[model samples]
Target: MSEQLVEALRGAVGDGHVLTDPDVVEAYAVDWSRRFRGPVLAVVRPADTAEVAAVVSACVTAGVPVLAQGGNTGLVGGSVPGADSAPTVILSTRRLTRLDPVAELAGQVTAGAGVVLADLHRHVRAAGWEYGVDLAARESATVGGTVGTNAGGIRVCCHGMTRAQVVGVEAVLPDGSVISHLGGLPKDNTGYDLTGLLVGSEGTLGVVTAARLRLVRPATGSAVALVGVCDAADALDLVRSSVPRGVRLLAAEIMDAGMLRHVCDVASVPWPLPQQHDHVLLLETESPADGDVAMDLPDDRDVVVALDAADKARFWSYRERAAEATAVLGVPHRFDVSVPMGSWDAFVSDMRARLRGIDEVEEVLVFGHLADGNLHVEVLGPEPEDERADVVVLAAVADHSGSISAEHGVGRAKAAYLALTRSPAEIATMRAIKAALDPHGLFNPGALLPSGPASPSRSS
Candidate 1:
């Protein structure tokens, strides 16, 4: 049956695109974090939406599960197959690379699922516009994967998440029916919003083949400032004050001295400030070139202004290389959480105190998008210490009415912890949705919601 499934996939896509070699398929079996892996029947590379539908149809006929993967750069275990589940086939969208003309769509651009996020940004930028969402993994992250996770990044403070930019989508449902709505309409109240549903389904319901993304005009003028603050509250206050009424804030990122110093050392970039402070804030303000916007940040010695594009990129590079720097230092239990804006400071304080108290915890580094109340915490230590710290961090986030997983979706790794943020009723509703869409669970199998008879779990 497995061999027949492979033969069917090859017929659907192409003989050359169907890879059954363990050496080649192994790379597609794991995720970016190397956290989850599973046995795959074969890796099928589909060139377009029709091919994806054909491949999914073949899996449906064979009673086999199908896992959809894009760039395979998801931090959570969403893109990887379930290790404990029956062998499933991976549908790689790398060959579905097509970027529609910007003029045709006016304020939007339709891109295939295989198009890289960074590449889309560049294509749009050439037309005097931008994709709006900016992530450190843009170069490797695909449009479909980002849309699947509803990704939020550094520019989310101003532009919002991938959901906000996804005006339309093209997907193949579990039954192999293609749902196409790749039209950027300002108002479309025709029926249920399947496009929105597919945006963050994480491949459980269907495969996202392409997307029509909303674009925004480039800021005529922009300024970036690095400021040292007393604490998270101080940094929040500055973020509020720095943005004038007319000016648009591109981003407001906060990083601790430990994280900043580590990134600087790894990137070999000079510290912009003379003395390292406990909290570092990267604030940016932009407006039309003809419009005048005042930058009224607190006057301090640590505040360094980036006068040009190169300087601004240099300052932003420090924040962009944070994850790589931490990885270089060592593997650590990592978390991406968001709390109420009011409890941001308290949550950070509580988490720091709790993590530091753990004997196994060697170091706790923090940084994130301050404007949106999302924080990325990295706890470095042995498995014993890091695992304990994970508990403490999740508890703290919940206590502050925060989400255990913020921008990053609740993939299989975070499935059990969904209770920390969602109530039992909410979880049940999610499960019901999953069952309604993919009744046989032929899609991702185990992911998102908690594992049960209704919905199984992906192997850790």
Candidate 2:
């Protein structure tokens, strides 16, 4: 049966594109975090949307599950097959590299799923524009994958998440049907919002092949301010001060001294501040209004303002590389959760104490987009219980009425604790939608939604 399935995929794509070599499949077997690895029947690289649809159709007919992959850079093990699942075909969109030329006048561009984010940025920048959302993984992350996860980055405070910029999506549904909504219209109140549904579905409902992304004007003038705060409460206060301001806030990032030191040591860049500070609030504002926007924070804190581009980049590099630096130090159990801005300080203090209670939790590093209350916590130890840590923090986040998973989707890592964020009725509704779309459960099995009694559907 596996042989027949491989042949069918090979026919949809090509013999050379269908990879059965264990060495070749190994790279696609595990996710970026290297947490989940599974046996894959084969890896299929489709060149175009037609090939993707054909591949999906063949897999559905063969009764083999399919895991859609783009750049294979997801942190939550979304692209990897589950360990207990049957042998499945890993669908790679690497060859779907077609990208429309940048439309400077329209402020938008349509790009295939395989178009790397960095490449897209370069193309857009050539036309004197920029993609709204940018991530540290832009070098390897694809537009489709970012859209699938509804990725949020430092710029999210200003430009919003990937979902807001996604004007249209082209995807192959679970039943091998191609749904193309590449209109890029500013207004469309038609039927169901299939585009929104698929954006954060994590490939469970459909495979995102391409997206028409909205572009925005690059900042004409920018300024950065690194303020040393005493604690999370002060950081929150600084964030609130930015509100109802004249300048456009580009990013508001908070990092501890430990995070800054680690990134500086890893990058060989000296810390910018003259004195050591426990907590640093990195604030950046950009505007087309005029010269550098005057930023005046409370006089109690030490502040360094960067009017030049070079200095601003230096400060941002530290905040942007927090996760990478932590990874370089050790593979820490990481959590990207968000609470309300009001509860940001309390939640962090509580979660920090809770994490310290565990003997295995060697160290805890906290940082994130403080403008939006999404905190990225990294914990290191001999053997970190990621799931246990997730539960502990998720419960705390719930108590504060916050989200369990912020930018990163549940994937397999947070699937077990999704109940903390969502109500039973909400989960049931999601299960029903899943059953209606993928009745055979052939697409991305064991992701996002937890497995439970099948919801009633038309087929049933």
Candidate 3:
């Protein structure tokens, strides 16, 4: 970053909050994926919305690009900073956290962008209410980052993804204007819906400061059934019949056998007997207090955790630990793709066979929120530090009519390949829309859009 940008950042946020040290900036340089790290002028930690706005405004004036980051647990290279990327400032959304709790029957709770997902769950769950999104990175992924990526985790089957749960949003436009329609009146259909436009913009459209998200009562009873299937196709059949169990089906997850072995090795969870099957699916169900069915059946599922605090944590740990397990193997290529549900059987078989035939590839681990047709793949191999494998795997997703990302935002890491799934005309429209919201291309430039790609229809 240039001296002018550093001076402006220091002025907006007190000197104590502005970090220009190479050591500190280096820490925020890369994400969990370690894919594409960029050059950073400084790391600005804002304490409140005002400070956040000030920092953003200063970056615009100085012509210094800004990258909004949260817990840095993102698998995509979205949060990474690099040196080739001109002078830039890293806006760390770490300090803007506050819990605003409302005790109404609907149980409304507003959280700051920096509040971690898991902590938000614990805060409201005591009222028999809960924040619906659950992911392995819940402990680290902040509300702002989750909203930026529209994250979908294990609960997607029953509760839906983050975008579905976000009834309101509070973001700062490129010009540092705060647009507060966060969880606004449900009946206001007077104009176009701008909240949806910003939610999945990947912080390229604007910086998300806070959100009014949907909250539901914690399931009175919950259970997880680990089922072994002979092939990937069999897993698809199970989901079609099992998901309609109504609210009882909290999540329906699938995992490859290779992943299970890694899970057993890295986590406290044990492996199955001599045979755990090549493909496995974990079906989760829930029961409300009025029904109380979960309490009545003890051996109903592979994993069950009721209102008991300890029991719930134990079962959830196993599912969320998949990321950690794969991370230990290597910095692998990961993608979140969504395809037609019916083609899952054929897609899995074909992709697995094709990947297996490649000598450059070593192992493949697949798991995700199957309910949304969103699959997460951690493609890795014996080659210890190989990183390009992720890029190759992502490009291959386009061949299957799958998205480059099922939920995770197209942060800087995926920015280079976003066009693979989106068509030329669609990309042109995107550029036009981006120009409307961020005219000079100042808001998180170089992300979500290739420097030369066209923009889409933007409302806000």
List the RMSD of every prediction in angstroms. Answer: 3.2, 3.8, 4.3
lDDT of each: 0.84, 0.84, 0.73
Model 1 RMSD to the real structure?
3.2
Candidate 1: global Cα-lDDT?
0.84
Regions more than 4 Å wrong, model 2: 242-244, 287-293, 297-300, 382-386, 452-460
Give the per-residue lDDT of model 2 (tens digit) for 1-460: 8898888888889999999999988999987776777779999999999999999999999899998899888888888997888888998888888889876667889999999999999998988888998988889999888988999988998999999999889999989999999978888999999999999898899889999989998888777889888777787777677534666888888898888888889999888677788889898777554346556676766888776778777878888788778777666777889988778878888888877767777777888888888888877774533456666667777777888789989887778777777877899899999999999998899899877544212111
In order of listing, the candidates' clash counts read 0, 0, 25
All candidates: TM-score: 0.94, 0.94, 0.88
Best by lDDT: 1
Q: Candidate 3 residues 1-460, lDDT tens each?
A: 4787777778888889888778877778867876667777788998888888898888888777788888988776677554367756888888878878754554567788899988888888866687888888877899999988888877777778788888778888888888888654655786777778878888788888888877877777665555666554676676565544455677777777787778888985666433457766666667554324332222322433233546556545556677788887776677777777765656666667767755778777887766677777777763534545544555556666777778887876567677777877877888888998778676667777777544221211
lDDT of 3 at 445: 74
Task: Give candidate 1's error at residue 310 in angstroms.
Answer: 1.5
- lDDT, candidate 2, residue 452? 58
The worst-scoring run of ten residues by lDDT in candidate 2 lies at 451-460
